[model samples]
Target: MTSTENEAHRRDGADPGHRHLFHVPPADGGRYPESAYLAGNSLGLQPRATRTELLADLDAWSRLGVEGHLEAERPWLPYHGLLTAPAARLVGARPSETVVMNSLTVNLHLLMVSFYRPAGERTRIVIEDTAFPSDSYAVRSQARFHGLDPDTTVVRLRPRDGEENLRTEDVTAFLAAEGHTVALVLLGGVNYLTGELLDIPAITAAGRAAGAVVGWDLAHAAGNVPLSLHDWDVDFAAWCSYKYLNSGPGALAGVFVHERHHGDTGLPRFEGWWSTAADTRFEMTPVSRPPATVEAWQISNPPIFAMGPVRTSLELFDAVGMPALRDRSLRLTGYLERLLDEVTADRPLTVVTPRDPARRGCQLSVRIGTGNANELTKRLRHEHGVIADAREPDIVRFAPVPLYSTYHDCWRVADALAATVEATS
Candidate 1:
């Protein structure tokens, strides 16, 4: 380990057991040791417990057949409930306000059905200028569904002419001026590309004061940082478990609807049998008696196999808890920043992610000012075994997840990046 890494370990008091909790894949077809796996912003490393938990679930399915729904180790019938308390704790929501089901965009559309009510002259939606493509598409489709043209109705808050990130004051100023005409304000809790953590509470309060429903797409924030969605009075939110949550690829996602919205018959939402009261769920009732909780948003039965990894990962998060995790995340990310300073020394690399811990998550988006970023990224991976993702044009993102990533991993990535720059230059 580098002296920097050893110093970090000594300073942070990192537990030796943390890395063992994850199954870090080997590099070079297992010929060499594992590379510095720093791409948790895209897909997290699998938890070691996931395999055992999944095997147990499969065994229950094999042994009990349909009886697994009620008799299995974790019970498939109320399976989604198994994740409720822990998932809620991750996002700082009440158990009654959260549900684990569906994929990320799917739940966004489902929540939008009830929350994005465009009416009269107030028929606009507000989002970030550089929102993740999927979120932009979903919002546009919702606007079109409501008979509004997306071009004029979809408002965006862009950074100032020379700024790399949006300022909180600017967001509130936009909301103060146009929040009245905005039917909904949807933003990423942590922006996907820039890694900026928007001021959700201030923005939520501003949007609500102007009488617009507000929601957050927490795809990049859920398990990477601490949240207080309940105290923040966020109207609703949704996030995928694959990123940071470490629940496998395309795993089931989570939804949060404030408890205040529960059981409101006037709320408009598409419902199926599973979205109703559990006792009457199997009654085959023609009328939808939606439950008095966020479960009412469910339209189908929980996927037992899909939730296997989610249960395993959430259990890990419950044991570690978000506060301790966030503390480690801050230090890890700060260490990455320090390493990047040394890597980019005498070079033209720039960090697009905010420097302040309060304004960003674990990911640091680095842009090369004078070279092909994608080519440099390829060299970093192929030559030095540093695995960071490159975005279009000129951005490479490295997410040193607190759960499994070590200070040694951060040092390795920086060392590789420095060498790659010199070779490419």
Candidate 2:
């Protein structure tokens, strides 16, 4: 190995991540046995404990049948409660303020039902221009549901001309000036494509000051960065578990509703059997007596099996803690950025993510200048076994997940790019 490659291995030796706890996929190419998996922003590797815990739940179902609801080791009836504290801890929320249920978009919609009160002059919903497509769709649909023209009711904030990422000052300025017309401000905590970490607390404070409800879609930020939604005074937030959370695909999502919003009977929400207080659930009352907690927003009983992976994953977060993870993330991503700087210096690629570690997470997105991103990613995977994510025409994302990625993984990415892309003359 070259001196640089040897250095990477040495760094891994000193700061060995929790790689042994998870299964790394075998490489389809390259000399290494394991693929340099750097796609945690898209999907995380499966934790070894997931299968063992999942099967135990399955056995409970097979053995105890209906009785498993009460008799299973992790009792299905109150199983979701097992996740609440850990999920709450993960996002710096109170147990009453957090609930693990539904998918990310579903939770956003449910929270919107109570928070997105567009009326008269304030009938606009504000979102980032480059928001994930799902968020864009959800907000537009919400505007339509309110009998407002989506084109008119939805206001998308864009970065300044020639800028790749939106500035915090720009976003706050817009909210200050036009926020009177904006009934809701929903933004991603960490942008999906560019990997920019927005100033959540500042933005949330700005929106609330402007008389707009502020909620966050933290799909990319939840486990990737340190967040204190409750302390940030965010009105509501939701995040998926399949990515940085290390849960299986389509795993259940977690939602946070600020304590200030709880017990506000004036607020509107759609309710179901599960939305009511658990103590009164079996009373079979015609009218739902929903609790004052975030659970009131829960529309239905969560699928037990779906909750299993999320629970298992949250437990891991609790064990390791975000502070430690974030420290390692900074080190790991910084190393990757330095390596990428060297590779992209002579290639037709540019790291689009912010240079400031505080402005982003573990993810680093490279904008391809001359090739199809999808095709390039496929080549990287099949030829070099550098598993990364591609976003259509130009952006390729590489997330050196703090939980499993190594310094060598980052080196491999740089090394592979150097070998694949031709340097400019």
Candidate 3:
């Protein structure tokens, strides 16, 4: 998996576009024309065929009028359903328990309303300290809505000294100790910063053992890795479809509420017309009896236009499959790691992401000492054409996405790093 094993890939020093699935940050053949791109973990490259699919949707809408809802091959009425099977498969859930709906934060709110039921002393929530800001906001708001102070109700876990990442043991122990008072355990499936993959299945089991509801924010994990939400007995989950799902920015997100929660009429939910059972939906009945599955969470008419790119993206995912993509992801990331190790052997740089494939995805966060990490990353982009991202004081995050990125992309970026080090020194 090391770069040395693939000489041509490492020795050629070519541009990443040649190894990527799609376009790179287009260079005008002006500066750093051979830049290596490794930023897909933040925003993925647009699929070349996405425009064609969007055009088809626009054309169909122009020609079909309102009839498109019921008449199109993928009728607008069941458009959300059409995306469910593939989306569910991508996340390892039953089709019936999944629904593509509001954005990530909104879905998190909806799931929290249903799952975060505080009673007696069990009124707190356990979340990571470094969760995405949006998630932290939602968790705080949920606590406020429930008339609890976030300082007391929200449990924030941090990494150990000299450790840039959270260990599974620490997470499990937190749940074991605080599960009793925790109303819900909400954690990101894959950390956005360090690209650390949390042990979701074991965490879910631990939360359940502590007698607390478990939910996951799969924003980073959905298409980046395989998920078995249903089999893991995950009580609920939410995800944005835009990332690796390739559904475009601000695309409709998705939610999964376990089937066991379906008939638990005792669990409260904020409902609307779309959640009303299908048989009586059009009857315009006054009584609101929700559908028997996760569709019960829908609060509005589905976004038909957003489904087009999702359908196309899911098709690509189905074609390649997660197993194959993850395999390649490991190889590409491992190659990059080895290259980085060699280049930084004498430097004070460290890879923060987990070395184990089972504990991480495609991302590797590089921490630099005694240098401006951000400036170096910027220099790498402007001088060498290596597209990576910097996080605050001293970390640079790079991701070699599988479906599109090749082993050569890894080496190109590694070489660019070596060159950048030489230039700065």
Candidate 4:
């Protein structure tokens, strides 16, 4: 093996991660036995424990039927509760401030229903220009829902002319200046396209200072990095489980409503039977008594099966805390960045994700300079067994998930790119 390759193996030996706990896909090409599964930022590998736990939940359904709600091993009726504390801990929030419910965007909309009150001249919603299409659509639709022209009501923040990542100062400055026009400041905690970790606390503070309720779409942030949403004083936040959280695709999402907002009856929330307090849920009362907890945002009974994977995944995260994961992530991604720097030196590629560790997460997004990103990713995958994701035009994202990803996995990515894309210099 080359010195660099040997270095990767040496590092793996020294700092091996929890790869054995998850299923790594077999390589479709290359001599390596396992594919360098670096796409966890897109969809995390299924945990070994998830299948077993999920099956147990299914068995309860098969054997007990409706009785499973009360008698199942995990108990379906309050099954969602099992996830609340762990999910809350993962994001550094109190159990009362957090709850896992519907999908990510659905949770965002539900939070917006309570938080996105555009009154008087403050009718704008601020989001990043490269905000995930779903967030862009959701916010724009929210503007339309309020009888406002989305074009005028939704402001998309962009990086300065020559920059790839948005600066924290720029965002705070914008809020300081135009924040009066903004009713809500909803941004991705991590920019999906650039892999940039925004200044969540600073931005939230700025938005709130400007009289706008601040929320976050943490689909790319949760489990990928350490968060203190409650401590950050964020008004609300929502995250999907399918990505770094290692839950299955379209998994149920978690939402955080600050404890301060818990019992505000004046806050508009679309309620249902499940939104009522758990004790009074089955009392069949004519009026709903929603708890002061974030669970009050829940609309329907959770799908027991859907909650299983997330619960199983959260247990794993709880076992291996975010601080430890983030430490490993910084080391793992820093290693990948060094490799990319060497490879991209001679190739038509540029790392668009911020170089500073504090400015980004486990993901490093590369801007392809000469070829179609999809085609390049196909070559990287089918030819080298390096699985990474690509944005339509030029960006390709590689996330060396700290849990299952190895130093060798990162080595394979650099090696794949070196062989596939000829050196331009």
For model 2, give the RMSD to the true fold.
1.3
User: What's the TM for model 2?
Assistant: 0.98
Number of backbone clashes in candidate 3: 3
lDDT of 3 by residue, 1-425 (tens): 23452683553344232234455566422244544667777777677777887787777788898998888766787777778899889999999899889899999998888899888999988898889999999999899998999889998889998887888899899888777888899999999889999999999999999999999999989899999999999999999977777678888888999999886788789889898987788999887889789998889988778778878888888877998888777877887888888878877778889888899998998887755878988877776667788887888898888776666667667877777776666
TM-score of each: 0.96, 0.98, 0.93, 0.98
Report the error of model 3 at residue 43, Å.
Answer: 1.0
**lDDT of candidate 3?**
0.82
- 3 or 4, which is superior by TM-score? 4
Candidate 1 colliding pairs: none
Clash totals for all models, in order? 0, 0, 3, 0
> Which residue ranges in model 2 land beyond 4 Å of their true spot?
1-3, 423-425
Question: Model 3 residue 419 lDDT?
Answer: 72
Error of 4 at 141 (Å): 0.6
Model 3: how far residue 1 lies from native, Å: 15
Tell me how candidate 4 scores on lDDT: 0.93
lDDT against the true structure, each candidate = 0.89, 0.93, 0.82, 0.93
**Model 4: per-residue Cα lDDT over 1-425, one tens digit each:** 14388899999999999999999999988888899998999999999999889899889889999999999888989888999999999999999999999999999889999999999999999999999999999999999999999999999999999999899999999999998888999999999999999999999999999999999999999999899999999999999999999999999999999999999989999999899999988889989899998999998999999999999999999998898999999999999999999888878899999999999999999988885899889988888889999998988999999999999999999888888778322
Distance from true location, Cα of 413 in model 4, Å: 0.2
Model 3 stretches with alpha carbons more than 4 Å out: 1-21, 28-35
lDDT per residue for candidate 2 within 145-240, as digits (tens), equals 999999989999999999899999999999999989999999999999999999999999999999999999999999999999889999999999
